[model samples]
Target: MKGTNYPNRWLIALAGIVMQICLGTVYGWSVFTKPLMAAHNWSNSEVTLTFTIAIGCLAISSAAGGYILDTKGARIVATIGGILFGLGTLITGYGDQIGSLTVIYIGYGLVCGLGLGFGYITPIATLVKWFPDKRGLITGLAVMGFGLGSLMLTMLSPGMIASMGTAMTFYIFGGIFLVAVTGAAQLMVEPPVDYVPAGWMSPIGKKSSDGMTLGQAVGSKYFYLLWTMLFLNITAGIALISQASPMAQELMPSTMSVGEKAMQAGVILGLFAIVNGLGRLLWASVSDKIGRRTVFIILFSTQAVAFYFLAGTKDMMMFTIICSYIYACYGGGFSTMPAYAADIFGTKYVGRIYGWMLTAWGAAGIMGPMLFSRIRQASGNYSEALIITAVGLAIALVLPLLAVPSKAKSKDAKVA
Candidate 1:
């Protein structure tokens, strides 16, 4: 497979990168919020709801998309996702012009969100198959693009808004995303039979504790433990992300210009994207060496400390570092879980099983932001919300230690 004649492994990784770039643009939501609010004279809560709706749609669509990817292959699933996402954004731009927040929510939230869900899963299973030996690293690299995609957009969207206005910016991004993703989708193909890359040991042949099939994996104690961990991790991260701008205001109130504030927010979000992207690869690759369980323990435990510090820190430098570390943990969690799933369950049905697991993220998506936002609204401060998030992370640290890999036998177990 590494014959240097259009290396298929790299090609597949490239496709994963492209797919993630499109998905990451949505992660750049914070960059758009101020502009959207200033232009439409809408309240903060109303604008924030759009993100909530989009995240909910992403969660539902991801589950469905996983099932489809298992059956239909990457090309079809991604192509359709691109088309839907593009159309959704096009309509969202029109909705923006007319000041129809409802239309924007439905189009960008539901339609584009579905596209993100569908597109997000295709690369995971494909990359797993492509580099069975380096599953963690490959998976991390692919998903890291999703995190970095926002960095690219964060840099571009502001200039685009300045030059072309927000509505036209959407149209431009919608078209560019459609073309890039569609082209990348075309490059994706399933791995061939008995395909083990050069010098790579097959995971199937490894002797370890017995594992479960996808079905049994879902039924095991450890599966739920992993799910709980993910839920806590996501909840903490989303709580911070959803309230970042407002939190900045409270911490630095009356000292910064509007332009300075916007710049600060953009810098924070951009750093989150960069750190998050780096974390996906960094932690996942580390897992390959130290084992997934150790990494999870470190991630959750460190994040608990970070979140606590984030709530108390008033210094800009300290605040930025803490926020970046938190973002890294969030992104690392997303990348690590699939490989973790493979470690516990055999990879035969990983696509479908991982999809099912992502529902935890979906649940957290709803709970995290709402919890923090509502608490902030009620108390006029985020200190309590931060404390709650820190507690959740601490709890997550313990769940992984309790998880014992499933010992059930399955028909698929004999194939290796």
Candidate 2:
């Protein structure tokens, strides 16, 4: 029998990227930190908490959203997520206008965050089924859009806030997200069951272990191992992101004006976002050839060295390069892990499986930034925190080494 021909998987991928770019707005939250602090007279940790809440919410909601994506469908979940995100943004603007931090937290952190989680999982879960032939490459591309989303924000936000103030910017962003994310979501369609690309065999055929349900995956050691590995990587990267602006300013000469410091920091943040997006594409694509385990091992090992260097470096060029590398590795973890989970657990229920796995992201999201900021606040410098981070990463290097798929039928069993 002839295989069923879908219109083009690339179209699905394109729509996924569009939705992700809007969802990626979460990564750009740092750009608002200083402005919000200045405008609202909030403390560093207080301002940072907004981003943390959003991330934590994103993780929690994604886990729930994944189950929905698996059972209900991607389009409805994505649409609702997009609407919540947009509404959240608009509400945050109102909160700012009212001088109410609580409202800001609800709008930007809780509501928008839930939107991010749902919007995030839909594409990744849907696209992997559509492109089993290029799991690593396609996932990389989708998340690469998410990484780049920050770049657009970094470039536009400075000017927007300067001209219209933070409140108006939030309102504008809310409108854009509502239209963009929801519209892109409308284009998403699940592939037919048992769909396979022409002339390419499903990786399931080349494996001894089949897909595991959410409960079965949770019951295994591999789930926690992978979860821990992702948590450590995300924590390290997110710590830097939570304070990328102030951290950069601290390293600059004292003679620089606050505006100058912010401008320079903005440049660094933009660079961080750019390399972050590209890294997802590069590292995940490489994983396809060299293997995900090797890529992760390389990421953990090298990033440990990078964090160590980042601790004591005062030279701007070296500092920026180190930050870029770390951000790239952080982005790589996001792009690679979905495919990694799919490979091990099987894609049959990846939406639900990977969504639960992202709870690590939620936990790390709260832990990473809060830990980094509180440490910096108390110690008056990020050096000690950076050093501590380096040690944590060095320890996590052993996880990927020990990570292996459970329930293999043979000792030599491997994922294709």
Candidate 3:
């Protein structure tokens, strides 16, 4: 295979960063909801349902986006994603203008969700190809941008809404995302032909543990174990995030003004993003030194503990600390998974395999929030909902211990 090195690897990573930043705006949906409700006089559940639609779209589109990325290459898929995302935002603004809930669901939920699915996949695939030697670290860095991007929007979007109004805010944010994501798409390229990282050899080239190719890996039990692990982690985290403001209100009913409650929620959410972003890097890098399986064990166990404690505590400081730790595990889980897949399955079809694995995320998107909201509605409190989340986390923690590493098919399996 002929190698091409026209675009620098760091530049590729930067492009991934840009793509994630745009994609991460979904995390800022909460900031828009209250304002939207005040302006339109919509019910809280009605406004919150918009987010549910967006997340549902994100899940469904992720599967399709993965297939597209594998077949068409990252550039075209991501460019399309950028366009869809921009249009979705623009349409969402129009939806707001018309007070049409359906338009918001279709435009922001379906279209932008499709865009997010495509945009999210490209960076993961590209970064893996570029940094084969440091798959975990590279994946961590690229995905950490996704986590941190939420922090950025959490800080910026509220002020933008205050000054510019909801429709204008969407228009501006959409345009900015379009420009940034489009430019990032232009910078994306597949890795060099027949290129191998320095001081590294293919697992097939050396004698080591046999592992499956991407195709074979998916068929194995370990794949499902990893899948379940991610599903549980994301479900818990999303549930917490979806109800963040309400949770804060419940905790500090007397002291917090509505604005203060929202601000505090924003702070907690931002802190989650920060810790989540940093945890991706920190945990994935640690996986390199300590081993992936070991790291998974630690993360899952810690997450279980955190979730258990989160259910009992209404203390703001304690809540923040516990949730932050949980977010770290959430972020770390995402960053580590690609490398984990690469470790077990070769990069031959890492993108597709990873995409398939992300079905866990999509499925969890539905289960987590649905479970939280439904249970809260039925029980008239969040405590029962949280306890259920803790149970889910505990269930997730068991999967890693039972996980069997992918077997090597050839010497190439060892190097990966």
The most accurate candidate by lDDT is 2
What is the per-residue lDDT of model 3 for residues 108-194, given as tens digits with 9 covering 90 to 100?
888898888888888897788778778779989988888888898777766676677778888888888889888889877776546
| 389 Cα displacement, candidate 1 (Å) | 0.3
Clashing pairs in 2: none
Ranking by lDDT: 2, 1, 3
Per residue, candidate 1 scores C-alpha lDDT tens digits across 343-391 of 6675566667777777787787778778877887788778888888888
Which of 2 and 3 is ahead in lDDT? Answer: 2
TM-score of each: 0.92, 0.96, 0.91
Every model's Cα RMSD, please? Answer: 3.6, 2.1, 3.0
Off by over 4 Å in 2: 1-3, 203-210, 406-416
Point to the candidate with the largest TM-score.
2
Q: Candidates' lDDT values, in order?
A: 0.78, 0.87, 0.76
Among all windows of ten consecutive residues in candidate 3, which has the lowest summed lDDT?
A: 407-416
Model 3 regions lying over 4 Å from their true place: 1-6, 204-215, 253-256, 406-416
List model 2 lDDT by residue over 127-164, tens digit each. Answer: 98887778889999999999988888887888888889
Candidate numbers, best TM-score first, in rank order: 2, 1, 3
